[model samples]
Target: MTGRRLTSLLAYVTTAATGASLLTGCGVLPGATGGSREPVTVMTWAPDQTRATNMPGMPAMAQAYARWVNSQGGLDGHELRVITCNEQNTSAGAADCARRAVRENAVAVVGSYSQNGRAFMAPLEAAGIPYIGGYGISEDEFTSPLSYPVNGGQASLIAGHGMQLAESCRKVSLVRPDTIAGDKLPGLLNSGLRKASHRSAIDIPALEDAAEYSQQADRARTKAGREDGCVTAVLGERTQTFFDSFRRLPTGAADGDAKGEEGGKDGKEPAVRISSVLGSVGQPVIDRTGGAHSPFEGAYVTGWYPEAADKSWAPMRKVIQEHAFADNRVDPADAGVQTTWIAYTVLKEVVEGLDQDTITAAKISHALDRGARIDTGGLTPTLRWKYEDLLGAPGFPRIVNHEVTFQVVRQGRLVAQKPGFVDVGETVLSAP
Candidate 1:
């Protein structure tokens, strides 16, 4: 038969197999094994060796989390079983990962990153598995009934970045990937800028996997530096490379302003300041690019969580030290790695909240649906999900954390620009 027809047939077969597994008392349904003290299994999937964003750290962190929890006698009394998948940055790859998660009888998929939300959400919903703490790359993450997104994803980041730029930047130029998923980014950012009555930013799309972004950088730099301008790039892993290209191009001294000895006797305004979100450009990149002298030295950044040096990360660092010490894949500062840590933190709370040794996918889903409040130490404001919790944002109905942390590169580190998170709930709700 046709490829589409074959996919449907395979899906039907998997559904049938899932039904059989549940009926055979395999602990796939709600409280399948009552107080049995069995293992609580979950899946974590992320792209690896892909043309764009690569999140190998997510799965590696999941495995490390499993080792850490299991060593401590697991979440509650059940062993934490983690099944990792490499999505390969493809829709088909994502679908395969979801099917594997269903077939393996995972209760939830936690702390993962994938741009192909539609491909994965269907299978997880079919099998009643909850998707917790997703990277928020796709729109379906906010709309899917089974998705419990911990952070605001790309939506909040772009919006917050715009607002952060409004007061200081006279002209803003956005550099983004030229992909279907990257299309919505420009509009989201414009919404925030419009809220401040600022003109919409210039949208510059470039090939996602291009080895060099020199041409795109040149165009962006010219437009962004026109008058107190800024260039913001959200091209995932390629963000740093894009800035590197921009930095190589010469930016000469200004001859217009000469005030005093302290204020640049003949100093001019910054040519074009660099900016990005957490996943695209962060501390790890800064450290590698010569720290304080990095291209992102004075860049503005937005993120879902606090800095890696924050004391809140100590617990996760301790776990990493004990279990993943030698594993180079686990970078405590990587956004995906930090996301996984938070997702597992939520899972641990959810499993323990059941107050029973036995657990299943249905049980977990229902509990979250019933408004379970989970506290992630102080990492995030206590996350409690309810129907009313939905912000009723245009397409993103399930976004609960409309807050984003404003950060800037200082002394080669990504430090908080403002003291706390900026609430962009109203800003996102007003997005076109």
Candidate 2:
């Protein structure tokens, strides 16, 4: 069969299986049968060996959370089965995974790590499945109710951070990848900075189409230089190329080496800081850039998870270390894993609250819309659904009563530079 034909046929099969599973509750059918117990299937990218190897802590963190959930008696006495698959970072793989989850009769699907969540979004919505922890801050994903995003929107983070920076400097330079996520950040940052003060100059590079790092970095540095001391913050990935270009610039070098005295030639060196709001996703790459090459000493980043210093995260951290990191011998740098775990926890709580023998997509949606709040005991912020917010958009519902925190990466380690959580207020996006 042709590829398109095959995909359509598979989708049909999956729909049929899902229907059967909802009806029979028997294990005989492909996706049918929760098998005597309610099933909650988590679909996330299988650990990428290349990325995981460099960051050995992630897989372990995911495993720990899965094991802990199973030990906790699972959702409604049903053992949770985590069905992870590698998407190869492709849309096709994500679509296939979404179909399989629905076909398999999963009460709720939790996870589609990174931007790959975009591919499964439509299918899950069509299937009426509730999704958690997948969509980033992309405008397209912000309007969908089928998806529940635990991580605050990326654009919100960029805007919040940019507003903070605009306080110190009037000029800002944004360095971002050429991807959709990268493209959206600059606009968000500019909007926020402009709101804070009308004098801010935002310089975004034209490297969206560039193929090589050297080219992108050169362009970014040129923009940085023109701003002079007025530029206060440098927001982007702290890659080796970024640092190399930044250090070559007279201002960057002076800021890095300057003691009590100012670093720039004019004794007014700009505060050149680099940030990647995605945190752990950017850490490995940041680490690879080498401390000598990339000095993030005074740079700040916005992250979804709390810093290790936050005592609030103790319970979550303990669980990860004891169950997830114990067998794997990994540290807690895998922010994605923690996010996945938190998403699953919320899903389990929402599902268990249904108090129904059999679960349906409509029922699950209702429970979430009722403003269910899953508390991770301060390990993470509270995630609650506001159905009223759902009416405004299509993707994940806009988070209400949410808090944001910022951290600085100093000497290759993340430090909680900001004091407490700052409320960004409600994020209401324009219709897509």
Candidate 3:
């Protein structure tokens, strides 16, 4: 459909959607009986059936939060009804879902899967709906007032972790897929490394396929001097290719034999440490590197959510264990589940803080600008909203400054090298 026509249709739908609330001066309908209440609907991209099972622990997490809100009497007796639809991981599908959400009079949206959330940004904004959750990394969508990013963007996370790496390593190499997420790594790391007050040599290869990463890894290993210099590697991938490539590379005595002993022909071996930003394939990376063939031994990774063992995340853990855990479905460690919890909590906060009985898109937007910090005990960083500065934006992106600290597996289990928490510092991007 044409943009103008689509815009007009959306406006009409939005009007119809909120007509009853407008007339009643509240979400409830007129002449409603005792205990009559308007249901606060939360829309997400995951289809109801699929989300309940496949997408990590989010369904349980969401349901747990819903139950918690309900137990607290649910936003002044208005019960929250979560309505999920599958965006099918496509922009068009996500936009269609957004339209449906407005048509259903959803107060806000949460849990958009990956770029699908970014795709729905325009429509959600046009429909005057607000959203929370992290998926979109693009700057344009993140800086907008209508959309609040709870999990933080990938680019920003990379920058933060890169800064941490620069403090200990002198040479850095990035191995990533050829997707949009992969493409943004070099620029993001370069900017991040500079801010950390260190200069490190960087290597980024254009990997069209995961198998092709072997060539890139080989080059990175050589440039990093095998095991002598303080070299760090940053890898990004959504497929098993990254893990496979890294595992295939020679390591330990085998590596020494293939490339000659330390200082035999190529001089001293380089002290190479590998690290990765959170990707869709993090589990595989952890699993592969934890085995005997582990290539990521001694590596560090940055992640959005805290692991289950993080002591700081005790509160969130209690909630998840008591309410979210059911059967074997919910895994709180999954980034998506943690993100959903944060988004739901933020939405609840905004709704409860409203002074007026009725809620409007404008009002919700305003509450977010006031910059509320949500402390869910440290499973994630304290989430805060920053107002728009002189840049003429509504606000700085909503940030959950949590970065996970993990050691690459040399043996079977993961070794904790540092405390895992969100990093909430302002990321200053600069020239590499």
Instruction: Please give the lDDT score for candidate 1.
Output: 0.84
Candidate 3 lDDT by residue in tens digits, 42-116: 776653333211353554566777666665566655666677676654567668888888888877887555454
Among these predicted structures, which one has the highest lDDT?
A: 1
TM-score of 3: 0.72
Q: Name the candidate that leads on TM-score.
A: 1
- How many residue pairs clash (N, CA or C atoms closer than 3 angstroms) in each of the candidate models, in the order given? 0, 9, 15
lDDT of 3: 0.56
Give RMSD to native, each candidate. Answer: 11.6, 11.5, 11.8
Winner of 1 and 2 under TM-score:
1
lDDT of 1 by residue, 260-368 (tens): 1111214333556678899998788888888876667777888988888899999999999999979888999989899899889989988889977678999998998
Per-model TM values vs. the true structure: 0.88, 0.74, 0.72
lDDT of 2 by residue, 240-337 (tens): 34445554544334233322112334534334444446442345544555642345444566666677556765666678766764454334444555
Candidate 1, superposed: residue stretches over 4 Å from native? 1-35, 250-269
